[model samples]
Target: MSGERRRVMILAYFYPPLAGGGVHRVLSFTRHLPAHGWDCTVVCAGPDDSWIRDPSLLDRVPAGTEVLRVGGGSGLALLQRLRGARTSATRSSTTIGWLRRAVDWFAFPDSYAGWAARARAVAARRLARGDISVLLSSSPPDSSHLAARSLARRFGLPWVADFRDPWVGLHFRTPPTPWHRARHRAAERAVVAEAAVVLAASHTHERELQALRGRDGRPLARSVVWLPNGYEPANAAASADAESPPRSRDGGAPTASTESRFLLVFTGTLALMDSTFTALEALARFVRARPAARSQLQMVLAGPYESSYAQRVAALGLADLVRLTGSLAHDQARALQRKADVLLLWKPLGVGYRTMVPGKLYEYLDAGRPILALLPSDDEAARMVLDAGGTVVPPGDAAAVERALEAAFGSWLQGGRVPERRPAWLTGHARERLAAELAGTLETIVKGRR
Candidate 1:
């Protein structure tokens, strides 16, 4: 282990071929870790119906990196299958409601818990060879960390638990029942206590993790690191260069024309927590004030969205101006972002949101288009937007959003110029650079174990 390159077993339930923003961080790590004297073997869940699968993502994984795909029983898949059949007999029933609750209460942490036992068995065999240096587990399905904790304890390996999102204090998810809450809280504490280091995706998350204590009321882990999400510079640059259209004379907004409508693009899942409805309301207000601009404006939601969003657009009479493009591959989404006149981000209003930076934010910044972010003025995402030369308006304020859109529209009409992002700012957020920093942290933990 001393002379040979360090080997890390990365347990990420969400990995390549899974079409979502969550895969990028781990993908980048596996791509760049070898350059920094580390090699990665990824253990991830096999394809499931729960998410859109993007086989193209597998091409991005570095050559020589071993990826072990383990199949597991997905609670989400089962629930979706149950809900898929809505017979007339069952349409007005309370049974489906009760079953939904049961699934929520039992799926501790996430549906991927079934993957943990399989992953542990795979990890155990890998560790027995005495070649692996450390265990790294990233999560949203916090189950990955749970498995890593068990493996580390059994194998006496230093474990690094990475939290891409909060487990117990998640903002967007429904509050679990009291029993489920206690279970999540206890499980989170156990993982944190066992890991040698914990990596949080945001500063606020770091502070929250640092404050966590075990059941005995003692601090869980001695070290917690802040590792925010970032953009892959090479991919971003290439996509923008190859796919983006020429900017309008006024600004980086795409050239305005009858065919080239003022496009506002939003990528990713449009969940209840997203500010889609708010954006729609603002668009409605904008169109009402300037009815002539209706034909000129267009909003493209370029990822999976709830069916309710389509109904909302129709209800608000915005179907003419809005296009709901169901889930696209990661590369296609980025291409759409690069081609956009304005990129849209909606951070829901909440104190917890201050610590949450959507993974898309970095990509938005990298896209180098004018960003119209509906977020609190003091939120972490807002700060990043401002620093990257994007515009920010408070979340849930339709008037403010309307004003920002008007300003962007006016700038486009006036032949205004897009501001150049600070080179220093952009450099700091490159995925390779962040991965190097992560490598250094992993090195320290490995050395300390000696």
Candidate 2:
């Protein structure tokens, strides 16, 4: 081990095979980290997280990256373990679900409490090796940050806490309760305070942290840094399709002729926060208002929406108009984007959303299709789209959205030029850039400790 690269033990509970936006970020960082003069040892959750699974993303991890896995239980399994229930049936029973949440309310700040014992034990052992230069923690389960705090306190290792999403602020979902909300906020303050540096994925989140105070009454400042998520140019270029002509979705002759049907598309999981259902309403209203525009315009939603939400679409009498294709494979999804006339993004309502910029936004920029965003006027998503030369509409204003759709359709139908894909802002080298920035922060923390 003479004159070798410094080591970083990454504690992220949501790693690959348990796919999502957060995992992608962590995986990309670890995969490209060696080039930045650091070798990584990733300690993350096992494969039991069944919500979103993709083996394709795993290929991004470098060939020899040392991965340490712990049996982090699934949402269901965590509840069962917490409740001390033996069987799935009992765990899912109505009474037990309430009880589990009630208990969770009082215990730890996040679900990562489930993996605390395993991560604490492994992290302490790994950091004691003297060769470990920095302990880095990324959170979604948010448990990873807490684990880093524990190991730093116990082993005297310098640590950096990476907030891919702020723990108590701007989460896509609603808070558990007043108590849980307070606990999460307080715990996040403690976790951030213990870190040598705190890295946030966006500037909006950095501001949110600046608004809060630490237990010792010192306002969190300078230690916080903003690292915006970007599109990886190398990955996009590697996956580029050179020969495919820009064709309409219905399979007509390749058109250099600009006139084509105005097809709007939303491409990701269609959860409660996403606006697929609301967008459908706007489309239906547009069709009702402009009978002649029926053949000229359409909306293709490509992802998994809850069954009840699907039923809502059907019940609203939009069965024939809105086409719902269940979750598409990643390649297929990108292909659909290339064929699209307009990219549609929806921002959820309320303050929690005012700060978040979704991962899909980066990919949308890479897609280069004209974007029609329905977001709050002050929302981060809208701001990013506006910065990238895309159109924005007010949230819940179905009529305004319908009007925007008509204008975009008119342009395409009346022989206006189609937009070109944006230059890749997210490149493989950008990951190297981000890694370098993070590595510098680690060095500062480690040196200060000595």
Candidate 3:
């Protein structure tokens, strides 16, 4: 079998060109997994202009790799249409909210459910092309798992299910009904049970997936790997100077004020699995009590944001202190991640959020920059940050966040921008190593079956 072609068919709904953890995870695997013995082929939903696209990432795909675009991506299009003309429509207030719910009721598994049959067909064709020894599916659009499950059952191919996020208590959106929620739970349980190997993004997620049993009450996947999100050592994380620095919507030289200005950078979405209210309030308090500090403050919300974020900033009287750069290209965002006095992060305050860690945390650690994070103290993410010598304040505790902010600001004022404390062990989170680990897991799985 080793003499036969060693290949993996990956059902990734959003691969390269689509910017996200799912894209980064699979892309890194495809790039480095080959050295560890598995070549790759990816099946993605053709194209949807609605989601953020970074054409830059397409360049990172390995020369001999194959990316197959399957269905016409009606999932995001339908999502855009159902939300009406308002791009900012919330789930509760959308004019077609009921219609959306009605549509979602039939959206068993996930929004990309429509792509399953098409994806299955494409996967069948690829499997027939020869010697694809293993099947892997990455999800958030959990529909990919559904497609892989079908192919696995039909062909008796050993499949690996990678859950970038939890399915049942998913962070993406609220499940429409109890039945829908139950359906997701059942689907997750089934995925864990059937996968030849299951990969969880973190230890907490590994526990969550393993906690579920099969439909017949059997234990889940024979193997589970704690494959946390990681950073690429070769990612060329050099900070690119912005074109004269990002400015506020109202317009002003961001660096003009103060004897000593400090930049707090956050380079990902505020809308998912995180909130900024605690961080925001802490900054507001830090500035109000020391009006002179306002002159030195600048925080960049450097990704997609809502209208209300600006309103909130204005309401807190720190509009001048905050800059929203909207969405940036992947390289641009990575540059921003490195060009900061201190990296700021917020995990949404709740028991649910503790089970997940943001993908950016490792990238931050890899950058060797100091971080000011607002997350639960006992969760896996906090422990990782603490290990790498970054600050973590308990979520929703504005006072604690403010204290951390002030401490970081003091470090910036003192001249080191916080003592460089990133540990040597963080190199373990490098994508190349993780890919090797994944390759070993896949090899073991293939051998066990023999």
Candidate 4:
């Protein structure tokens, strides 16, 4: 290219105005890459009502950044609607099962396979114009990597495939049949073999990718890098002021002393698979054992939860102690985190849970409050919290949680002053620094081509 600054075309299906934790990583990359002499152009899905839409996130995008919005309908939402219709029909169970299997087989990596064509076409047009110097694709709807692989091969460009979540070995989904599993493995191998570099969100994920071998029995990718998620300092600074006092829905300051009650806050999606039930049980146990403690403690769940979860909390007779604030915007959630006396982090109970770390961990640390993490001792999240001077208890250990709560409550009662010691490791994971590291890696790839 003629310009001194190299360009990277990012293919991400999840981008802002779609509100979720998944968009932050790519958004940060786009925001900071320019400072490191790497410009970015993002191609992502267009607005869809079926998904949670947060127009406020658009403000976070860097000015003058070119974004290509592709509209081909949301394949994932369409599949869910079809499944609902099939369930309502009088079709045989076997037939419905077969149809679901067919969809899974055809979709390959994810239901958003349909978006691959449009994304590739947009990237190809830019590449043909001598615009994009390198290709970077991030995924969960792994179809983005498939598109990147095809375009890279066609245009002879160096590609970096980033896996935010494991494709085949994901613990949340039911295991596929032998044939489907083999096909998924083959596709993963192909992407790894073709890409110049592979990026995994965790060290464990990097090790897994490094273990994959090509058809010639050689290591799959030329290099595999661990590109973990991080926190944005600006967002942290904006919400840090919330630590002053709790606010009402109308943004009114606390009428009573904020220290009158020990506030524990959890912010994120609440699902059956997560440790929500375990945390609630622990709270109930603690309250029931010492009824007076309930008067001085309150736990707020600042996210959407199933109706059954509320019912369960009521059944436990701890409804008065727990508040479920449906769903809040990203900034609002951070504000809540900042106001809390203790932030709660829970890892879902399942196989491979130890290898994964939730994106919220960084935000929790950035909040500068004490964290009570309910996760396995061996998990990466647990290690980070411990390193950052936070508390940790094994998942499902109500007794341990109760003890921790009791101690935290006692500390709150006596002055409520928790020392703020930002861990040294946190500086290494800052969004700007990580983006600079990535920029250097991309520069290395671009220079090699020259």
What C-alpha lDDT values do all the predictions have? 0.76, 0.68, 0.74, 0.76
Instruction: Tell me the TM-score of each prediction against the true structure.
Output: 0.88, 0.83, 0.88, 0.87
Model 4 residue 148 CA deviation (Å) reads 1.1
- What is the C-alpha lDDT profile of model 1 across 122-221, one tens digit per residue? 8788788888888999987788888999898898889999888777334435546777667766787788777898999998889988898766887777
Candidate 3 segments exceeding 4 Å error = 1-4, 74-76, 82-106, 168-176, 214-218, 234-260
Of models 2 and 3, which has the larger lDDT?
Answer: 3
lDDT of 3 by residue, 224-273 (tens): 88998888763553444332455443344544432256878887765533
Q: What is the C-alpha RMSD of each candidate to the true structure, in Å?
A: 5.5, 5.7, 3.6, 5.0
Writing each residue's lDDT as its tens digit, candidate 4 over 185-304 gives 778788888888898888877888898877788887899989888888635455443334444323454434445678898887665434777778889988888888877888887665
For candidate 1, report its TM-score: 0.88
Cα deviation of 118, candidate 1, in Å: 2.5
Residue 148 accuracy (lDDT) in model 2: 84
Residue 59 alpha-carbon offset, candidate 4, angstroms: 0.5
By summed lDDT, the worst window of 10 consecutive residues in model 3 runs over: 86-95
Model 4: ten consecutive residues of lowest lDDT: 85-94
**Cα lDDT over the full model 3:** 0.74
